[model samples]
Target: MSLSVMILEKEGGLAQTEFLEPSRKGYCLSCLDAVKTLQETGRFGEAQNELEDALRESENWREMAVACLLLGELFNKWGAASPSYTIAIMEKGAIYANRAVQLWQIARDEKLFEENPEDMDHLSSALYWKALNLASVAGLGGCERWTVLEALQAATEAAEQMSAMEDKKHSASEVKARRDFVEGIIVFCRAKALEGNHVSPTDFSDCYHQDTKDEVNFLRHQCLELFISAQEILSAGKQTMCDQNIKATTMIAVTYRLLGEREKAISWSEKEVQGRLQLHGEWNPRTQLAKRNLSMLKGITDEDEIEEDCCKLFSFESARSIKSEEITWSLDPFKLSSTWRMNCLLKIFLLTGVVKEFQIEEDKLIKFLQKVRKSYHDENPFHNWYHAWSVTHCAFMLMKETAIGKILGMKEKLAVLIACLTHDLSHPGVNSDFLIKSASPIALQFPFSNVLEQMHWDEARSLFEEGRETNFLSHVQEELRAEILEMVHQGILATDMQIHKQIVNSLSNRRDSLADFEEDDMTLLSDKAMTVYDATSPADRLELFKAVVHCADLSGQVMEAPVAYSFGRAVLEEFHQQAQREKMENLQESAFMKNLHE
Candidate 1:
């Protein structure tokens, strides 16, 4: 036995040796046959119910354990069939597996294993499923209460049993493959934790990275070797080993991508796409996603192409016809594309007199806007450049149509507008919850709260750093510049949905408190409302500005029905993609996200 195996058995208080035989009569034969028939016919839900019913009805400990193990396997199949094998589903599998282990322990206490040595075979299978399910949900940071170390221990126990069995069902090579795959997952999870970029294995987002950090690259190289080894071993096993082999193949491709070996990554990805198509068919979501990945790899292009197009497409002249009448809250960002979006944004700034009042150089302003637009991930369905433009335009509409414009100084207005523009810089197409649960490097650095919001603020700070030419605030007076920067930070942080209700409640409370004034005073204040607003405390003004930007960030639902519907669909598509990744990576799906579909 390996050191890990020996240590696990000792720590778990399990026996060092056991004798077992494959059941010639296969325990609970009739019940299993019915479940298998349902599974084979693709009625996995029905199969799951049947096994669950069997578990409750069985009197004998051995029979109950067998039923529990079958139920665990059926849940696995059910989840995989849905193509959304979430952490919740994996937890259910782990529950059944744990029950099986407990049932077998009862059998061991009653000396049933001695009467029927085949009972040990069922115990070994239960151990294996328990380990695999725990590992799936454990992730790098530990999900619920399951940890990778626990999975490692369970796998070691299972390997010990398989090794000592007199009539093992799995061949020696297949057993080794299983062990290697589990070890590979541990290493892969570590690499993911270190690397910080948590894009899925099949996600080709930002595929042209110059290099990964040395530490992450080293771990990935180790993972690649183990996955390759497991794949080779599983290749010699029965067709039942095909799914495991495909998993290995996917990891190999992902590791190669992380290492910046595009040729190898593409080659392995092609094979994975083919395997997915064969196993799941063309219409299956996983298969469709695989095909999309393959297409992205084959279609990799020069990153400069977008920059060059932006330079050629945008100018002040492009915004000549963009008037207040044409551009309102009803503006559809989906129809505008990059060129018109950039132009419309410039026109809004011009209309608000932000450019002239701040004495911003036109060339510097264009360069700054171009860089800001490039910072957004065009690949993201919702939080991309178009979303940024839409948010900024909504803020502009509020300023023009409401009293918000008269209430703020020029600096505050400019800061809030800039905040809307860069709020989602370099989004990885996933949310803060994902980062925290996956133990991503970003989460480790930010820790506990406002994970994505803090990261976005950091990126925005980099773009607006004092001395850079792209920093449009460079020529502004030092005292005024500091004020704008502080407000920008507050504005960006305000966009975090975590604090949305607090902002709304504060704003509403302040509005309601205005009713306390005498009617005569209120009549006098109505004509000079701007005077009353400007005389309010600076802290109150800042809070009000934060509310404005926060509202603009979520302005989609308040737009015209058709435009709102389009934006809603785009939002759902982005959410579905994140939920899909959560499922594929064995992380917990967001409750609100699940509710959206329901």
Candidate 2:
């Protein structure tokens, strides 16, 4: 009897069925039949038990391998239903897959399938399934990093082997199907490598060292190539059983976007969106995700236009002015005459030539300064408007040192100053770390923290949104907007600590080419580079910014001991409130707070 018939018999009646096939005379295909019936009926636990019983009675390597592979697939599906079962399911799957691979090797070595085409196919199928199981386990997070690496290596080898077999003159249709299956496995491994724990090897391994960016870039390219190959193969067939093509295409688009290939990324995304919409008809999860991504891509393409539209969507109201005589600080003693100073500075060294002195718009500058001041937290001490003002002045000072300072001149200085002052305006009173750890909805929406910095540009755009009558950049050409946006995005993303060290290291290594100094004056260039480097490096510049804002946020701390004490108490109270919420939800407290309490 065929396997399908045995499955039907087991489902129809819980009786041991005997097959008349010569090869299966002593084999217990009935055990597989029972497991299949149970699995089809959604009785996973029962199916698992049946498979375990079958394993004990099975002596044939082929039968044992098939049974184990089935068990692994069943466990994988069960684990998807509940995360609590993930570890158990993954462990069992790995164990069975390993066993199947070993059995396949033994069968091949014993020459049991030298002329048996059916048995040879079965052995290869077992090996392919084993690799699939390993890849799936590695894709699930919390597995050891080495396990993922090994799985990826195994999947790649299996895929190459299958592809070679498919190229043979007498290769069967079944061989082609197996080859496609292996390709899918390879793609899964690529995605896992990209999205899984991506920390540097130093964090977990003692023998291996690899540059994180280089590794990510290599793997990302591999995924794209595999995706393209899969697409070509899938297109040749009218229909594919695995649905790997669409999934691989989506991942390729996402990876391209992550790699900053905006144009190609947007193209792939648009294609995926159109294809899915044609297939699914309406707003399913895939369609919605595609739409959202398309919207983001459009925003990136014509940022100024989107910002203008947003401003037209919402209007801002001016605050009511307070009477000078009525203003009092009785409740908060720190609200008195406390001297505020900014602790950080941004020095912009202009390499181009300059011009002449022009009239300074003092009131406009003060407004920009005030905007920066407002970004500071009520308790933060390190950052404030003064620091912004200092940075603006430093940039101007550097500009004055350039030949371009003698040309169109003070207008450029005013522009740079205005940019610096308004850079960090409307601060959210939290660091990037806080945003990431809290899984703030904004972080989820963008998946890139630097995108949040676009908020500043948004605010800047608001001023001219209404018919461009009051728009500051409205007088400027549209061509300049894209260039300015790029500069601003780069500067803001540079502030993030995660990418900071890498950026600095890259700069340091390329100093000779980037410094652009004469041979005799190379020493001067080195010194200048060091200065610029130190000013922007995380250890110095970022720390300075943090300290400045932190001090400004806690400016009240300097007023009186009691006032500082109250501020600290309020912060502690907020932490306690958050901790209570986490406790109620059965979640652990944040690591920082957990450390504090311990």
Which prediction has the highest lDDT against the true structure?
1
* Shift of residue 450 alpha carbon in model 2, Å: 34
Q: lDDT, candidate 2, residue 104?
A: 68
Q: Which 10 residues in a row give candidate 1 its minimum summed lDDT?
A: 1-10
Global Cα lDDT for candidate 2: 0.46
For candidate 2, lDDT tens digit of each residue in 1-598?
1122223322232221211222432555646676556534534345546657778877776778766655554444344323323544565666675676677667778875553555544445555655665666655643553366676566567556545542333234434544654565555454454444533344434312265445556655765676666556665564332234454466567667656676777787787787667654355544665676565554333534554443332211110122222222222423422212221111121122111122212222222233345454444332334334434433443334432233222333334544555555554544444444454433322324553454444444333231222233333433344344334334444434565556545534534554465555542123454443354343443332322222222344443466557555555554554555556656555554443334
Model 1 lDDT tens row, 1-598: 1111112122121121121221444654445654445423434345546656666777767667776776565444433332222356667777887788888877788776773545666776687677666555544334566654554455456545544555456677876776677667656655553343432222323233334445456657776888898888887565422667777888788677656576888899888888877765666545665675564454322453456665656666677677668877667888766677888877887888878888877666776687678778888878888778878988888778767777777887898888999888878888988987765545533544677787787777655543343667767764577688779889989999999999978855555456555544532224344544553578767976898889889988888887688778879988988888888899888866664565
lDDT for each candidate structure: 0.66, 0.46
TM-score of candidate 2 on Cα atoms, chains taken together:
0.38
Question: Where is model 2 poorest over a 10-residue stretch in terms of lDDT?
Answer: 346-355
Candidate 2, residue 155: Cα displacement in angstroms equals 3.6
After best superposition, candidate 2 residue 538: deviation in angstroms? 23
lDDT of 1 at 256: 78
In order of appearance, the predictions have TM-scores of 0.50, 0.38
